[model samples]
Target: MTIAIRMPPDVQSVQIGEQAVVFIDDFLTEPTEMVEAACQSQFSPCPGYEQGKGYPGLRATAPSEYSLRLVELLEPLIKINFQVPEQLDLNKSACEFSLTTVAPDRLGVMQRTPHFDSSSPYHMAVLLYLCGPEHGGTGFYRHKATGFQRITSENLQTYSDVYSDELHRAPPKPRYFDDSDDHFQFLGMMPARFNRLVVYPGSLLHSACINPGIGVCADPRRGRLTVNTFFDS
Candidate 1:
């Protein structure tokens, strides 16, 4: 179900399951500009993923400038009475934010992998697309029994079995195979538009869908440029 809340004249909020994703028309003007600056600044390689490296990125260059604006705009939605406890703290809440530029090759393997978020109930994630919808969109899913929806690559990294290429690599997990009849129920897909931000429980199961019939290097330009953060309540 889609529920809408007006933050004011131009900004709006939408809640899907336990996740609250807020959208601000021109709210990201400054933050977007900051991100562009970071992309060119002395960037850092992303922590775990070898395939990804953030140019100086926002996390270091001008983090306070980049995050304060986002925190301010999202404060209203964060203060709402959500079911998850980790997403409720207003005064003590903290988040890890970064700028990401996904190369085309990495996006291919990601599409076929289904993963879970390992964060406990106290953590949620927000992803802001700095690019356009044509790049790639965020996919959300509802896990059985768990009821949690809207997953991302960050969530899958929690399970060692999923990340270790050698363990579950060659044959693939039985559950992920077609014959297993295992499939995630689609919760929703976040639009990949500039300034479009998607926030959801970090523990949800989600993944990025690969562009069909496209080679990794065919159009390296087709990948996504996103700024993401993980919040703890």
Candidate 2:
């Protein structure tokens, strides 16, 4: 089978505080067939996400040839936006097809609130939207008390302490965080679009704006399917 690949030209990027969310349109060329096949196959429950009823989805270290090709296309953008080192450590990266397994009402504390992918500023996250807008988008937020949108290694402890206290003070309501409350200020939002890829710092406080009305399906073809990846340079 032949895969069609198109290189994006001068992608647009939006800056949110210390982080940038680069948007790449037409990220993949005809990826539906491959994605559907993967979704229909067996997928193990993702650890640490089960409590929230979040779909575990599948992960693969050995990516397909098409995925490797896409990486090559993304490298230039990463180097420019993230200022990544010349030598990228692919060994630490994997491709994940995330599915929303949990319902909004069933979300746990951590799942209900926004979270950072990592405390390290050097780490980056790339989320490729494979589904439509109904799957929901992503939102960035700032801790009201700390005025911090991105937690770094230096402030991780402090942020954690403050966050824990805030949680204790007012437990999160059973639902996905949609807007700023007394504790967090909503910074920005990135709408999910088919074949759209968003690249941002892993340290940014963000959350998936899940549409609770839509039953979180295990099928990648119909669910909130996304290719979530992390990179360390």
Structural similarity to truth (TM-score) of each candidate: 0.60, 0.89
Supply the TM-score for candidate 2: 0.89
Top candidate by TM-score: 2
lDDT by residue for model 1 (89-161), tens: 6442333334333444443243244454445654556676655666456565665433435434455443444
| Superposed model 1: Cα runs more than 4 Å off | 1-21, 50-62, 81-112, 143-182, 210-223
Error of 1 at 144 (Å): 6.3
Best by lDDT: 2
Q: Which pairs of residues have clashing backbones in candidate 1? A: 42-56, 43-55, 43-56, 86-122, 116-155, 117-155, 151-205, 151-206
lDDT of candidate 2?
A: 0.75
Clash count for each candidate, listed in order shown = 8, 3
lDDT of 2 at 48: 63
lDDT (tens digit, per residue) of candidate 2 on 31-103: 6755765656566667766565333333433236656765777777777778776676532377766777676
